[model samples]
Target: MKTPFALAAMTALLLPAALPARSAADPVFTAAAMRAHVEFLADDLLQGRDTGSEGHEIAARYVASQFDGLGLKPAGDAGGWLQRIAFQQTERTNIPAVLTLTGPAGDKSWTHGTDVIVGLNPDEPKVDLSAPLVFVGYGIENARMGLNDYAGLDVKGKIVVTLRGYPKGLPSEEGAHLSATKAKVAEAHGAVGMLSVATLQSMKARPWARMLTFANEPDFTWVDTDGQAHVDAPGIRAAASVNEPVVAALFAGAPQSIAAIRKQADKPGGKPRGFALKGSARIQVESVGKRVASPNVVGILPGSDPVLQREYVVLSAHLDHIGISEAKPDDKPDTDRINNGALDNAAGIATLLEVARAMALSPEKPRRSIIFLASTGEEKGLLGADYFARHPAVPVRQIVGNVDLDMPLLLYPFTDVIAFGANHSTLGPIVANAVAPMTIKLSPDPMPQEGIFVRSDHYMFVKQGVPAVFLATGFANGGEKAWGDFLGGAYHHPGDDMNQKIDWNAGARFAEANYRITRALADSDAAPLWYQADFFGDTFAPNAKKAAH
Candidate 1:
């Protein structure tokens, strides 16, 4: 394959030059200014701004400097612009060479990488357990939905085996979020451990070899004020994802064969019934972890109105990337190995900084204070944002709204934008009004299957009852091809550097739109409220007030 630079250079030459010309370049949010920031943040020296790495700290400091230059007040930890957060990094040190299953027929063994892929627990460094198995269809427990996979089964002190993914009929947004909580459901159901058997569908989507590669990657979780890792339910001792062969072995002599369960799950609206498996699986995992600290650079532009000043409107963008490349070795030594994350988030941070500059320079200040937050560890499961939500710099209740900037595709002159979670709250109209001046259409999510609503830093604040929206350039005017090409070629790879066909004007417009949104939220008579009966709002803030649609 050609080098990333070579490919990007070629793509740049193919891009059309029919973009609309700016009437008068905005002083605050200019393409030149945007380019300057992106050039530095996505520079080769920063290495990819991985969480808790020196590269990330340097990136955090750069954002802090930008915040400082904007004359904003420090809104992070204790009078400083950077919120130093502690994290616990976990990596599997050892895995059992051969995992064995004991059944009524005989003992069967399979090696680790071939039949199963297991993850290490941060809370438990060393764990060895053998317990009776219970196959609980999807292992979901949502009392609100009246769906409890553990209803009839008594899985106490047993290893619960569950099929991967949630029920197929649910909406993609909710389905994705629900699938993420299955592990916690097992823990809540008093299971000693959880094993998820890969479905035929899941394997086809993501092959077993890919699963094995990611299984060895390090896992990180923020350390709370109580010195506890804020990820994974503590009740479960070990967890593993197994292939079809291993799953068949566990289901031997059961009421339903593995094939039957697979077929039932494949059928529309067919819920697989749970039953106790006539086998006991044994698992052992040894993990090593250490405490490290990263910074979430934050600053505030205080409001003029005393009453509204007490309330806050937050503007956030993640400052970290996927770190370095993990590509295979080849004879081509000229291949660029650093994942620069130019569009993945360096561009987003730059957009946020420009917005801060614009907001700070406005003679007419906002009624409510606006916090400019450049978060760390966003690529690592939104850890920094989650930490800030649980342990906030300001009063959590006083924070009114959040606008998170994350990976806005700045390649094309986007005529539309996708505001994720816009429909869920009053922020919808606000976002629409904010972008209307530029004649930019507020487009619906074209790729809801990506589950972007719950995947970004803003979702953490939403979980804390803050009405939030994530903005991105929509798939319009050849944006679909750009997005497809970038995601396939440059995303998270060495190719996401400053050499790509980055439209700086689009970056500026994105910043301008966000600045308007933040200002409007800050100056609004009332804070953004959840639409009545919204899932996230109802789940996170049950008793909070809601807005009529």
Candidate 2:
């Protein structure tokens, strides 16, 4: 039996041949061209392209200039290529915030960062919290999952200590929703403070040292039209992430052992229970805030069809990366301090630029307009993308689809690509068709446990009911070990610089696939639509109109 994907690929191949042939003189993606872009953007002179920093502004200007050189129309604020994103930055003071637990074994003080990492609510810069501690398994209140960690507990004015993640067996989206809303759920239940303990899974993914590396990094939130920073779980006065030993201390006199509770939480289909602890907690933190501006570079390529031109297909990539790290003595004598973010995202932006240039120079124009967006503050929790989604230059409804390029690790030769969120919408078949002629297999996410679908800039579009897909080089043709080595060694480290091994041809192939995907979305008669029974569709776009067939 021919699968729907196979049928779609056959139709795509036939239709492309029927359309007017593109000129041979049209600009094609080349490894050298892509390398030029990546090299410039990822250069150490850019100082890691930190959001709102001078280096980031320079990078933004470079992208804008590239758009101008390619003759793309400015599609950002005030007819400029830059859409300035207003942000509120919150920085914690260097003074150690304190966490003291008074239990059966007597009171114990935990040092900040060493014992627990504490952060005060931005709304309340200085908070002195003295409240009873309650153990709420995961602190989740998800009715859809038929589990409420706080259902039987009255946590009014108490500090809720919860595990980091959702239940083991729930669907990823469901778990993600529950986990994301845990803080708000706790606040709604009258909790005054929150203390999060890393789960076994989280601990394995990131060690304490890696987690503490960013302890001093500023937290950013998009400023609203009213100029107020967006706040989540407003009433929570204090929050802290405690180490494993601290978790043990918090449960010293509890009815059940912390080990037993963690065991239950780790088990499949396990539901850890909530209970009150025998003691109280004292939490304190101090923070300050400042307003800053970042730019999201946007440009538009008008389509040939007047009617279809009103609709748009968006190609997005984040342009920001973690900035220079403080100089520290390491075992490696030649360790680079700047996190150039070559593979983390400079590669993605380079690919976006190449795609834009190719589309601009192509003789055959797409039917729908294509928007090229190089967003900022993605490393700071997708702030720029979220802001743009909320306040778009065009109506959000007019965005037909999004193809996001982020961290396509071109570390080795690759025969396949992974398209996250491919299963959720018509975009699935479109992507299949796009990659079919390239002789590249579209593989499923090998690491579903990462919950990557909601972790990138495309997720902001998905939340706005736009059908979107995020592309990454897949683990095939000996790419798995390459990927593992990259993540384990250079993912966010200074080693992510251009000096690291990069397959330029692989990058060119990545850009080519993206270009094909974008062209298909822009030229297709029908817009992308969420699959009828998709969880995201049901939850986010229940009333979304179907695309014309």
Pairs of residues at least 3 apart in sequence or in different chains that clash in candidate 1:
none
Could you tell me how far off, in angstroms, the CA of residue 545 lies in candidate 2 after the best superposition? 3.8
TM-score result, candidate 2: 0.92
Give the residue spans of candidate 1 off by over 4 A.
1-28, 94-98
Cα lDDT of candidate 2 equals 0.88
lDDT per residue for candidate 1 within 332-429, as digits (tens), equals 77777888999989998998899888778777878999888889999889988988888777899999999999999999999999999898899999
lDDT of 2 by residue, 1-549 (tens): 667998888998899889868669545678898899989999999999999899999999999999999999998889999999888888888767899998888888886778688875657777789999999998887665688888789899999999887889887755775688787999899999999987777788777887787777777888888987887888788888888778888988789988888888888877889999989999977888888999999999998999999999999999999888877765476666889999889999999999998899888888999999999999999889998888887899999899899999988889999999988888988998988988998998788777888899999999899999899999999889988898889988889988887999999999999988998999898998987766787678989965432
What's the distance in Å from true for residue 211, model 1? Answer: 2.4
Candidate 1 TM-score, C-alpha based: 0.92
